[model samples]
Target: MRRYCLAAFLLLVLAAPAHAQAPAASLPKVAVFDFELFDTSLQGETDGPRTDEHDRLLRAGDQIRKGLAESGRYAIVDIAPVNAAAHEKNLQACGGCDVQLAQQLGADLAVTGVVQKVSNLILNMNIYMRNARTGHIVASMSADLRGNTDESWTRTASWLLRNRLLAPDFGRPQ
Candidate 1:
């Protein structure tokens, strides 16, 4: 009886690790593209694009990629292969082309974002994730940032990632 008990205990211990690894191994592969900015602010129209906002766009993309990867829910595939196409085309306005590019990268989901600036004080930041094969949006989140400063945008990205972006069953179809 003691030997049988020991055997069962070992089996349970070994099974625990295997079960734990299963979910992580099966996490969806996602390709996160660079974020784009649509500036409609007076500063942009008259004075032309601000260099600072361009840097912000780069940071926003990095933040999203890191957040998703650390969530243990997605495997972030590198989007470098399609970087040119991503930069040249407005992924949001291209009518499912983002999905096609992501699919070519062997990704299960395609992710992109945009920051629309109405002025120095008003901005809308949005992130989108779509099924690469189906070309259907599975998850999306947006934040309205009041200040155009880097701190506000960074904090908003962090908040959105923590609260809505990776929430329970965030993208899974109900």
Candidate 2:
């Protein structure tokens, strides 16, 4: 009787859920959209060499897209190739900005972000995921890239990837 009871208890425990509430499944096929830059460059610094803000944002976006796709959590569809459609239509925000077009190309989700200057040497960014079918935002996150060091981009990529693999409510209340 004792052995049978112990076995039953163990079976029940093993079958129970680890968390009472968990998201159904991970969002797949995410596209990292363009990183919008809110320029805060000094106006009168003509003497100092100008950094191409647009190029930096594009590099960051590429880094994010590559990082997320490499994680195996998503099938990354490089929207850059199809960006001309958005430009022609002037569909900017990237969140429902091109859901119909994205669906046509067979992407399930899109990741978009913005890079803004909170202060000199401190850049703030918000990265988000959008569902292609419903055209709804599924997840969002923000991080600071400080001092333009190598670690800055690494941290940003890490945060973006973490949010993609793990459900939004995995670590906190939804």
Candidate 3:
């Protein structure tokens, strides 16, 4: 009986390591949309959007997509197929239109963000993730930026993803 018990214990121990090393289950797919700008400052009011604002918006969306993909947190569904269709309306104002589009792309969640400019000197960047089926927000994060320069915008986006949005405790209500 003792010999039999010892043999079983050894086999269990050997199998445990293999199980632990198995590849992780695939992550949920998400559709990440382009970031939009909401300009509230007087300059934005008078001059319309800055000439380079469109470029900035594209970069912001790319940053979030790259961060999420590199972190292995989500399987990003390519938005290129539906990018033009999405641009037909503003996702920010469409009231869950983003979720519907994500569903059409076979995604489980939809991601969106906006950069709100109070002035050239003050801005806030925010990102939101919503369940495609439920259309409920799953997680969101924001960061305040002091400069409108490219470096500031890029760094803030990265920081928000690395420290807040992607943090282990993120998405849990306080």
- Candidate No. with top lDDT: 1
Candidate 1 Cα deviation (angstroms), residue 47: 1.6
Q: Candidate 2's C-alpha lDDT?
A: 0.63
Stretches off by above 4 angstroms in model 1 are 1-25
TM-score of 1: 0.86
lDDT of 3 at 104: 92
lDDT of 1 by residue, 50-160 (tens): 788889988988998999888778888999898898889999999898999998899988988999999999999999989888988898889999999999889988888
* Quality of model 3 by C-alpha lDDT: 0.85
Model 1's alpha-carbon lDDT is 0.87
Assess the local accuracy of residue 138 in candidate 1 as a C-alpha lDDT between 0 and 100.
91
- lDDT of every predicted structure (CA atoms): 0.87, 0.63, 0.85
* TM-scores, all models, native as reference: 0.86, 0.62, 0.82
lDDT of 3 at 89: 78
- Candidate 1 residue 162 C-alpha distance from true site, Å: 1.2
Instruction: Mark the 10 consecutive residues where model 3 has the least summed lDDT.
Output: 17-26
Q: Give the per-residue lDDT of model 2 (tens digit) for 1-174.
A: 999999999999998987643332453666556666554656314334236655666777788777765644456676766776754553345336667767766778766667666455887777766677787767667777786544675577567666643544421112
The better-scoring model by TM-score among 1 and 2 is: 1
Stronger candidate by lDDT (1 vs 3):
1
Query: Using TM-score as the measure, what is the rank order of every candidate, best first?
Result: 1, 3, 2
